[model samples]
Target: MSGRKAELVEQVARIRDLDLRLLDRVSREALTLDRNWMVEYARWQSGNWQTMSLYNDSGDPSDVAIRDCEARETTVLEHMPATRELLRSFGLKYMWVRIARLPANTFLWEHSDYRDLADLERHRLHIPLHTNRSATLTLGGARVHLGYGSLWRLVPTNRHGACNLSGPDRLHIIMDCYADDTFRDLTSNLTLDDNDIQWLPEATDGEISAHLDEAVALGKLGYHQAAEHSLLKLFYQYSMPEGMGYDLVIRAYEMMGEHARAEQWRLEKKVKLCLA
Candidate 1:
């Protein structure tokens, strides 16, 4: 296995069957708040997905930009007393805390987080408040249905995506915490077992052809970026040959008569995936 794959396997861990009563309460309170939940990170995301920041740098609920982390609470946190107490009980330094909601038929495109940072001293954790069987997280070529009442540590540096094919709004309390001795001790007993890993089947040639046809149709409809995102999402959804997604994106641009853009995506694929 590559170093990156090994890191992902080692970093992602789950502590199942935690008491999530506080998180449930917080999710209800979050729905009542009129705070803005728009996410600005990726334009490809559907509007059905929303995010509410509880803890951030300036304590501004509208500010969703990821920056130097802080522990200040936004206005949304005022009504979440139980959540506050629960987080404090961890006895670890906190950074950013947010609630992400994904309604039925919504999906987050495949992407990695915190790549711009030089030092990765913080770890991202997820506590599922509400989810369904159809809601799934695809990471490191494995599809996982994270059950409710569990704490999961996600490897933010790895490529990952999420989808809620059918749901009553999948909600999760996501936290970024400083990795300290306390955090290490908390996860000391947790081990990555075979049961925790569920590999997605490889995409058949027919499926790949159908995806390409859909991409072509999307481009004809002038949704070029969405078309490209769809192709890139295949990389996370199924096991494919290296650089296949990038090549498809380049082809999509070429078909649109955008040679410069096509070449740009080709080079981007090389740099991002470290393809020689």
Candidate 2:
């Protein structure tokens, strides 16, 4: 067995916390950035998830077309000296870098990334600047709070999602890089503590039925979007069979006599979740 597999069991786990730490200066500089520069980008996100690009192909802060490119620092990074210094210290081949913000009651729906990128050895890293206990990521049957001070490695190919359940927006510097010796060395000390993980409890049949009924009620009241969001949020709230949230949405639509909408969601489920 390889060294990483011997330590982690799975070579490509959903998320891992590295022993590496980000400089306090960098975190402070990141927090000093004005929020007005942030632009809302609609990707797989379901709610108020915004981003300000630091590095990309076009140098446009709003142009968030993530792909393998010779990324250059955008004008937005020009004012963030500490952040720029930190990135230079890493010396890794970066594909894209951005400052991501997830406000209260926001969510990034369960989905894998990098599906459209060319097949290569790439990884995603996150450094939290401002966050709260309510900000968490869920994947592989567990929820994680990507706490401050540590650099986190996330395998974007795994089906995962994130949410900030309540007040106080969350901020993190997100980096996508191609694997190299420096990148390997940075993750060599990857470790996770039991306290960092919150295993989700499986939803009971009764609970599932109750949730479905609530969604149906909202749908009948002309709050179809809210109803759909309620069902989709189940993935973060409970550990059930894979794709159960999407199934609940389809079932709720069917119960409301919206067969066309139900079928549309069925196709959406396949595409969004990348179901085979």
Candidate 3:
């Protein structure tokens, strides 16, 4: 990592933990509201996952689409006084804010956001309201178990995903804020120690083969999209070389006798990775 990038990682890792009681309060407040969860299918996410917007540029509660960072207005904050107060305490310029929920035994496929031209320079912060040991955020080959009552800065530029494996519903209040002097001040003193990092193990050949087999079976059942998603998910499940998951997708398409489609994915992979 470059010096600046390494500094950011350390700063984010050193973010001060929030109070547990405040997190519990926010959780209770969130639970009291009627659920208005929506999924971003275009992102190729899977399982029972959804998000509720609390703040956005439109100030429309129903608008949960993640968009370019901008000055935002509160949507559901009137109903979530505690949450509003909590955010106000930070005194940072906020952009989009939302509560994301991932039910038990669900997985969010690996993906990156804020990579497009429309995306503005900003940082994503997370406050875990409800989570268990099994809920993990995987990024840069490290699996992070962010405990409750703690604030974490997610690296939006990196390939990352989340999973709630055999756990209760996992919920997080995510806030997008523009980087500014105040942001720098808040993170300047924070430093992530070595113990804070946990590296993921490389997948065994048997494990990779078994997953590919499952993907193939899904394709045979005529669920081509599911099969593709299954193959794409391997990027998160294993410590494979860059673009290996994309290569597997092409292979899966070929296995299904879709030569044309395989070639299409081969090109798409390049575009997706900006290699084209």
Error of 3 at 215 (Å): 2.7
Residue 183 error, candidate 2, Å: 1.1
Order by lDDT, highest first: 2, 3, 1
Q: Per-candidate RMSD vs. true structure?
A: 3.7, 3.4, 3.4
Report the number of the highest-TM-score candidate.
2
Instruction: Output the number of the lDDT-best candidate.
Output: 2
Model 1: per-residue Cα lDDT over 73-97, one tens digit each: 8876777787777667778777888
Ranking by TM-score: 2, 3, 1
* Tens digits of lDDT, candidate 2, 1-276: 445233332322324442234467776776777754554436467766878888899988777668899899988777777788888878988999988889899888887778677889998988887899888888777778888777788887777889999848898889999999999888876666665677789899999999999999999999998999999999898976767888999999999999999999888778767764
Q: Estimate each model's TM-score.
A: 0.82, 0.89, 0.84
> Measured by C-alpha RMSD in angstroms, how accurate is candidate 2?
3.4
| Clash pairs for candidate 3 | none
Which residue pairs clash within candidate 1?
A: none
Note the Cα lDDT for every prediction shown. Answer: 0.73, 0.80, 0.73
Q: How accurate is candidate 3 locally (lDDT)?
A: 0.73
